[model samples]
Target: MTAVLATLNLGVERHGPWTSVGRSGIDKRPVDHRVQARTWGLEGDLIADKRVHGGPDKAVYAFAREDAVFWQEELGRDVGPGNFGENFSTTGLDVTGAEVGEQWAIGDAVFEVIRARKPCRVFAGFWDVPDLVKRFIAHGAPGAYLRTLQEGSVGAGDAIEVIRRPGHGVTIGYMLRALTTEPHLLPRFLDAPEMLPKHHEKARKWLAARELEKSNP
Candidate 1:
């Protein structure tokens, strides 16, 4: 029910050929002190691509510190906190298992689980791994993209407190799978009202397209 914020990461604009925007906030570095957490995003966090990277629905990304250990073992390297481009690297909570619409309060900030991270071409480019996106998708710990519900200060070492948890069983992992490799499970995400509106639209559109294909075929 509680987790410690292991690291708070913020980044500056960095040029990269991974996106048409030619910039990325993926190169984040850990911040030891508290930072402002706003509805838009962290105060000093770098967001070069508003369209693809930062927005209200994808405000603050979080990854479990425990999951980082798994990657360390799998990749045979030190996958430390903030290495995954998450704003908060945390402990004692299942970030991947976070249900859509789940709410958590840490320090002065409150957040809601809006969706899961979509590892695109930029993600692979950031890591310099051609198959990074595929590997991350298969890992099933894609991390949680959170929407800030309240403006507050968030820093490392603060305890994350869950304020509300939706009963819907659709988690970040399930949402990612449904959106990517598992079309058969799309119904689970589509029917969950707690899911982000955009993702709900995505699943609904995919299902409609499929139905149309069946009829036309």
Candidate 2:
């Protein structure tokens, strides 16, 4: 069976107390029509925190519907597609365990997985769960952040074909762990050349800090 790119969602920043303009794009809702997939992101999608959230490297955020099901069971609440502010909600896609450089052909657009999503305050606030950031880290289904390699229109019901797999064995799941609880596994994250440049730099910084601490202590 083929994986389905089930839904496309978009949202604009709303007024909040978080930033000077209080910007957040977490209130994504499903679009009934095709959305234009561009190099930066879905056309008309408003990203309040462009500095971190939206860019070429993270042009699209994809969450697996299976992971959403997990959340539904854990929270004992309804979690539907686009509930997590992801641009793409997929069914049957193993994004959590995918290689960093995996390529996907979704409708007319092609994307390459670059890294994993890291939970932050904006996400926690959107869910109204103060400890959500911590909880999400523990859950560890951070999803895959993909870069648009070929831009075009992508809509719901598109078939997601894995065009290529990266040379590294570093799955998004393993990468999330290495960057979080499994600090000692930093070396593994470092070894993956397909990893997002910022993430690679972060792991190095973290490892360097640990070494410094050990030396000082």
Candidate 3:
């Protein structure tokens, strides 16, 4: 399936409780001269890829259309329950199956799903709803974080294609569950063939903890 940009939104950081952000653009007509220029020699402008920072639980996650549905149903709105920075909001693609290391082509740009996102307390502040963080954990709509595999332009109406899948059956959701419910299980999760380096370190810590537990028990 192909995902077309149903909407294009952008926002600058604002100082406030949970930050009052709003959509910057909708379906507006392109200027004729600009279109003519692009039709001739000028190339189209490239959309910026969103970035995430901070720890796992406090990390920002971005979702396309289908994933957005999960957030709306779970959080009762289009945007998530945090001041999550999502520069490119997409539609018509299922992001749940995205695996780490798998490359996705959106227009000329290629990005790899690097990891699964985790929710934080900022979510509750954004929605002004209590226990929102818990709600996100319960719903499990934390979107995938992607890194640029090949830099190129991406915009609305770009098609997304999965170039590869991890050899292991383990998914982002599985890892998140393991991290939250059974931190001791991190070793097993890391053994997955597709485990990233960061996860490998986490597994090592878990293994150490497991050894300590065994000695104490």
What is the full ranking by TM-score, best candidate first?
1, 2, 3
**Model 2 / residue 174 / CA error / Å:** 0.9
lDDT of 3 by residue, 14-127 (tens): 344452233211112222221111111113322221232422221213466566566667656655312344434556655655555566765666666666667654446645
Per-residue alpha-carbon lDDT of candidate 1 for residues 1-217, written as tens digits (9 for 90 to 100): 5688888999766787785587778877898889999888999998887877778888899999888888888878887677788999899999999999899999988999988898888778877789999999999999999999898998999999888988878999998898889977887786678786777777788789989999999
RMSD per prediction, one decimal? 1.9, 2.2, 7.3
Position 2, candidate 1: lDDT: 62
After best superposition, candidate 1 residue 214: deviation in angstroms? 6.0
- Candidates arranged by lDDT, highest first: 1, 2, 3
TM-score of each: 0.92, 0.90, 0.70
Q: TM-score of the candidate numbered 1?
A: 0.92
Off by over 4 Å in 2: 18-21, 203-217
Distance from true position, residue 131, model 3, in Å? 1.4
lDDT of each: 0.86, 0.85, 0.52
Task: Write one digit per residue (lDDT tens) for candidate 2, span 87-114.
Answer: 9999988998889899999989899999
| Deviating ranges (above 4 Å) for candidate 3 | 4-8, 19-61, 74-84, 192-196
Q: In model 1, which regions exceed 4 Å deviation? A: 209-217
Q: If both were scored by TM-score, which would come out higher, candidate 2 or candidate 3?
A: 2
